[model samples]
Target: MEFANEPIFQWMSQFAYQPGMVYAGLIAMMALSAVGFPLPEEVTLISVGILAFMGAHPAHFPPPYEGAPVVNVHTAAIIAFTAVVASDTLIYVIGRVFGRKLLYHPRVHKFFPEHMMKRVEEWTHKYGAYACGIFRFTPGLRFPGHLACGMLRYPVWKFLVIDGIAALISVPTQIYLLAHYGEPILKYLRQFKLVLFGIIGLLVIYFVAKKIHQRWAARAASR
Candidate 1:
């Protein structure tokens, strides 16, 4: 609760204090995140966990209200999982309705891009339907990957089963962990933001460098 003094915590707590607002916010944010909004879903779920742990419910709000409702961690987790599945399903439906045409559209192309789309397509092809499960764990690939699955005519049941399993593993775990062990984990996250970013940057650089080297080696091999 003392962590409410932090700006990020305070911001989330504001919404959390309002009855039903936090669930609505989480649904919107998680849906957008699954569809490729820049904000990561994990962070959002973790924030919700921290807020729930801190008891940032209507009952905790300061004012004339003497008895307010408590925040429901289970409800929050369920909402998050549903939001993720819903968003991913929306994209998959778009791909199914439009088929290959969706991939060719200029605006959609921007999200997939040519090279990145190719990589995702390759993985999906190599792994078949299971790619849905794999892509669930790979952030940059999720949008294009799921879209490709539908465009490629993957079965609906398969997509749902694979994706749901992956989401079950990821979405609920973060919420449960933070809801229970939130204080220390949140403190660690706040303290290590810079470190986390630095590691992500380094990984990006390494992958780019490795790709460049591979291309160079291929060209030299023909000579």
Candidate 2:
């Protein structure tokens, strides 16, 4: 609903106004988003849903032109799902082929860092194949977790199965929900965004406090 006034609304509306540009753009952006680019995949899907609600096809695109392709809920979901899986698989392969050596590279470490990689390494060892599914739900953890899974030599078939299952649960849900309930869902998402950020901030504070306490305790014990 807010897209009516926003710049992105104007930008995406151009694509939405066209009969087929929505699908092409969504597939491309979704692929980029899955690979950890800053592109907002979920927001784009929701916009596609709204476009579906408004009938993305031109007003003249009814009747005899019904056979012609246009952006719709089903097509959007399928394309998004496939794009997500493909991009994620590509990242997994990059990690597998390059292994720990890539993860340790200074340029890569600037994004993935040694600490995050170590945490992901522990998680992979603890959870084995299931960690792939776990990482699918975790945004910041995905790059490192998937990479760690490969560096740790997790089975490729198992990685695909787990990641695919997680994608099934996450991908279609966003597109269909927005398509069916655009305004209310966006409102809820806006509110949920604040709450989610607050929660993450509190978790960060708690962990830092806990680490400081542990360090102090260790010093006292040494004395």
Candidate 3:
């Protein structure tokens, strides 16, 4: 596919021959993303998926890589699932240890602003421990939402069970599907890139507008 030539894909291709390094990099990226790294966790997951695809179809790759050991899709998926849960559990531990006091730390407060924290509190109250599932689904809210789950003292077991289920549904599925069906998927993506991007743009605008309206309502309520 044309995307194989893209810079990010090209970079990932280098790891096609080193399964160990690929797994290590995946764990590192997931850990960093869990702890407020600027990059999205999906990017790393997608890269891993692509790399797994390359490994299975080594003939598509050039030179030495064609005969080298590479990432296995199933193993990659397992590592991804474990890494994500571990990273998320770490965030929960931090919140539980620090309690609400953690929220007010200068470094932390900036990430979980007053408005955002208020929403997190509302979700916790509304959904109880089940809100952990919501947090797992929403990328922008994951870090702060998971933190609030711990701060509010939801049972650690419940958080793990719920988050683990969500992670299972999301993490491994991406890798398996991409590795098995990369060519068709890439072809479709290239064909409908504009349509897909436009839909994404609209979703972003809708969420931004919703947030602004919520903030305005909050301000009015205070008055």
Candidate 4:
């Protein structure tokens, strides 16, 4: 697979004008992603970041009408963090609830890709499912990472910590970039062919590691 293209960004950009749209959208996006439905967050994040830069909302400062100082970067970051945490928390609940039977059942297999399922199996074995943190930003496996965590029987606290750490690393940078450069970064993205390919390459590495780990684990079990 490949990193997402302009169309995804374009679609998300359409929602930029709606009031409080990104607040809702950000929550939904993270929630859905946590549940194993993958959407490229770059567009959603950039849109939110840029909109904050524009008048749709302010990134660092609260609106003038609040009769108080506008929300600052620190506050904005906290709010953004809350949205992601809420979404990931829901997915963690799904994992805790349905993990044991997810892959063994026939219906789920139909909905999920077999190869990726096998890969997740391997990755969970190696990293103990909390590795969802590691796979959180991987191109194709970000959502699957959550499902894999459940399948591996990862503890909730460990899963949360790992996922939280990963989010802190990824979310802030996207927000910072958008807050500063706004939509222009999106334009720059269109021209960066190499970056798109690099993303695909990283995803390739992620799956490749999964395959290797699975093989190694099977060998160890047999021994």
Candidate 5:
């Protein structure tokens, strides 16, 4: 995939000239995501990875940005890792401070639907602090899941250890791999973008059908 032709890359490239701004933006995105921002942190991470790749291969970018300072891949990875852990910890703190009350708050409740909240609770009940890893891996569940961990009053050290390990395994590795092998990966993504979209669409339909089936079963049981 030509970096210049990709609109996401084009938009992010504008910040390559000011690496500090890029880092700040990434931290802000991660923090917002922790508080249930509609955008996923993965999008920001992937964008950072692509930006790092472009920085390493400035010639691949168009003019103006071509001469800009590079966004160091390692530095970006460290910043991303730190930002993710810190933001997630903030969610944990909110849960700790407000306890269950935060969950019932009108604004907060809207972000976490009942079914999803049930799933988070189930995972926590089953796995204990280890469930923090599950929440870290699961995109939609992260915010509420982390909050639940805090609400349960799991040890701060345990939460940090578990979440940090998960972040270490996922966050920096993604940026590093993309920085090193982004061209081929992007090429494969471009080629299979339609296939990926189809798979995602099918998954959505399956989940919706399952939810309807579950509700119907509950209604029948009540009758």
Candidate 6:
């Protein structure tokens, strides 16, 4: 835990001030996580959060298509959405390439519980690669999801297309919210006021609900 928060990690914080560097980092970081490194994506995202506050965009351009001197958060998110999609897609392919070897490694195998891996395989087999979107938000399960798609032989073109659509939904919205309350977020955190708890709480609820659904389905399958 301490290692993850050390000067090394803080140094990664420098990506916040550099737009090209940050996007590159985001791609590389997500790819690394998607490739099974287990560096916390949330922590990488928080750097972007601080950068967003600093008026730095982690994305390439973000969108609106309006002609003017410039666009705002929405535009920036739109522009960067494509990059986000590409990053995850490449990671998915990398996962497919190394899925079996990674699965055999004791550490990587731990990321996927034996039974859960079976469930992911079954689900992806039935539902196809679109499951990536559903599983992408899942922190621990993400790599497994990619592997499952690969194992199930989900079509690559379809997977990439669906991943892009999902990125469109996920990346921009996250960036926008980070920008919206950038200063207040920093101020509150400094003061320990923490109103962002509401947003984080909602995401937790979403995760818990998904977990519950997965568990219930698993139990039913056993029955």
Candidate 5 overall lDDT versus native:
0.81
lDDT to native, each model: 0.75, 0.70, 0.80, 0.60, 0.81, 0.59
Candidate 6 wrong stretches, greater than 4 Å:
1-17, 56-83, 94-111, 193-223
Once fitted onto the true fold, the runs of candidate 1 whose alpha carbons sit more than 4 angstroms away are: 1-12, 56-64, 189-223
Best-performing candidate as measured by TM-score: 3
- Residue pairs of candidate 3 with colliding backbone atoms: none
- Where does candidate 1 have its weakest 10-residue lDDT segment? 56-65
Which segments of model 3 are wrong by more than 4 Å? Answer: 1-11, 63-66, 189-223
Worst ten-residue run, lDDT, model 4? Answer: 66-75
Q: Write the per-residue lDDT of candidate 4 for residues 150-186, one digit (tens) a residue.
A: 6556777887788889888887677776766655565
Residues 1-223, candidate 3: write the lDDT tens digits. Answer: 6666655456657787789998999999989878666566887887788788877765565436336788899899999999999999999988989888886665566555577778888998999999988888777678888888888888999999999999999889989888898888766766776897698688768756765665566556557
User: TM-score order of candidates, best first?
Assistant: 3, 5, 1, 2, 4, 6
TM-score per candidate: 0.77, 0.70, 0.80, 0.63, 0.79, 0.59
Model 6 agreement with the true structure over 194-220: per-residue lDDT tens digits? 456566677668756755665566566
- Residues 95-153 of candidate 5: C-alpha lDDT, one tens digit per residue: 99999988867556654567888999999999999998889989778989999999999
Worst 10 residues of 5 by lDDT: 58-67
Per-candidate total of colliding backbone pairs? 0, 0, 0, 6, 0, 7
Model 4's TM-score against the true structure: 0.63
Task: State which candidate, 1 or 4, has the greater TM-score.
Answer: 1
Q: Provide the lDDT at 140 for model 1.
A: 72
Quick one: best lDDT, which candidate? 5
